[model samples]
Target: MPLRAEGLGKTFRSARGAAVRALDGIDLSIAPGEFVSILGPSGCGKSTLLAILAGLDKATQGAAVVGGKPVTAPLVDAGVMFQRDLLLDWHTCEDNILMQFKMRGQPTAPHRDRARELLALVGMESAAQRYPRELSGGMRQRVAICRALVHEPPLLFLDEPFGALDALTRENLNTELAALTAHSGATVVFVTHGIDEAVFLGDRAVVMSARPGRIIADVRIDLPHPRGAHIRELPEFTAYTARLRKLLAHDGRPDHREGVRP
Candidate 1:
């Protein structure tokens, strides 16, 4: 198995006695080296699902299995990135990237070299010695990408990693990230609210319904990879996005299926 979630569900108690259901019966299987994106509206449990998948939080209800084993806690094999790079302001970019190794308390010679290569991979090798304050927003995100890949994780979980950037910058990074994920052969589960971004980066965009979030649409992008910049200008891209929008516009919820206890 690459990463599989079976009957995943979560309910949290608020200040009041009532409970809020964040996710409901989310069953997803990401094949090894595939790129998949989770798309949903705000407060639709996209991040909550990502947290569960990343092993940062446990599902109140199901099981997550990775590489044929159950995911009981955070797994080092999957790297994670969020909206913010969250680099230490005082540390040089290279040092900040290397922090992943320090956190794991693992030996670093080979991984350190790999980190530098990752920096270069994102076109930030020259900024390796510079501090976060010295880099622009896009550059900081580039460093974040390098940091996420430094450990050479077989899987990557990204939660709105480009949500804060300007449109042009976000587009640029989207292209770069697609290329990098392809080059590295890492399976990716990305979360985003932007439909265009979902279409551009994901091999298939999985759309979730509002509130008690669950998969509502699984739209495949049939375009070839190493996708050229002009691919988005094609009619097929617009058609797929329009179809997803139409599906989401409908009010139906996912059918409850029987599975192992969550």
Candidate 2:
């Protein structure tokens, strides 16, 4: 499903009645099956913009629509994954994947096969019987990703899902996730600080300005798909990364915490 936003604005009142503008006049469009990664500084409204579109919050001005429907409340057609795995400590991985269906009051039998298949794709089939406590951080996140996609939602939102992992592990998950998102054919809005990860997974990268966030630049990734470690060594990869770095380093305040989540 396509996503469209127009003149979107969000404002929050401070403790002392000070109004803080988080997002202002943001216009964005994401086509079906396109993965767009959002990169920005901490105070920037990366998560806030997502919240409005995902129906986690309301927009102060303008409107956000998914598949032509206004996002005034939580939509069942969308799935969200956060930085934390949020897996249930007691439920088995299989149950965790089925949890979404159960919560939706939808039949679980129809999606059981898909749940198992997604687990195998991430090489976690053998661990399906294990609980979250029995798995490592990487394993837990793999399940989280599966849980998010189990229902086959057309629109997916992920906020720094791999931020807590080590570099090597994060890279591995990034590769797996890109492949999975492709296979599932979901239009994704992924917010991340890692420029390489952003470019690696997205069809396009959207860079946001500082506070009162608005898109500052949009860079298309013409690199090859099913991208591996070797792709990073290519000149195009370096050029894209360098361009994003230059954009983030503007105004004498280099966004050193680009990899840090808000």
Candidate 3:
């Protein structure tokens, strides 16, 4: 589940037939089982880079390799979660999770236990039979997480999965996600705009620049795993957040002078 991008670049043609660069000279390597958070501004190519890495889109100038193979199409071994829950209103929660296997033309019975386990992990066990319309926003998102993980994919790509939730709900889910995936041995690439969220959950925070995006910094989060909400109050946690904030404030012009405060 290791991922590598070599000299990756992407460009698009505007509606008016103008060329617009979205990414450039991006060289990044993520080790297996590492959780890397991608942090950037709104218009930066974070989502675009993620799409290319996940093989949903092709890089215009370089290559993306996953698990020792060139990514030519969508990866079957990877699981993706987006900002919205995307659950079907008619399907029950457990059935929503089971749909992953159904879509892959795989047997659902064999994966039922795992689906239930994931639901219990996110405190949704009792709601397994509930439809999406009956669940709260956070509960719906928990089901989405279970759906993404029930297949036990070796790689997970999350694009602002908690961005739509309120602050308290987001923080609670952050803690749950850390605990859920702590030992899953999955290489996770999480894209988010929250510095604290990145620091709390990532083994490394990969900061990106503005449009025509490029990596500005790859910061190592030295905090212990199984991080809880209280960990955010620790000085080390604040230091990491501060460093990331400074890097982002530069808007792609990282201050090399600012060393790791932790």
Candidate lDDT values, in order: 0.85, 0.90, 0.91
lDDT of 3 at 233: 85
Error of 1 at 119 (Å): 2.2
lDDT of 2 by residue, 1-262 (tens): 9998889999998899999999988999999999999999998898999999999999999999888988989878788999999999989999999999999999888998999999999899998888999988999999999999999899999999999989988998898998888888999999999999998898999999888898888899999887777777899988999999888867224568789988
Give me the overall lDDT of model 1: 0.85
Best by TM-score: 3
Give candidate 2 misplaced runs (Cα > 4 Å): 251-262
What is the C-alpha local distance difference test score of candidate 2?
Answer: 0.90
Tens-place lDDT per residue, model 1, 1-262, is 2888899998988998799998889898889988998887778898998888888988998877888787889887788999988989999998888888888887666677777888887788899889999889999999999888877789899999998899988888888888888888999999987778888888888988887888887877887778657878989989978877776666245445546477
Ranking by TM-score: 3, 2, 1
Q: Candidate 2 or 3, higher lDDT?
A: 3
lDDT by residue (191-230, candidate 3, tens digit) is 9999999999999999999988999899999998678888
The local distance difference test score of model 3 is 0.91
Rate residue 246 of model 3 by lDDT: 90
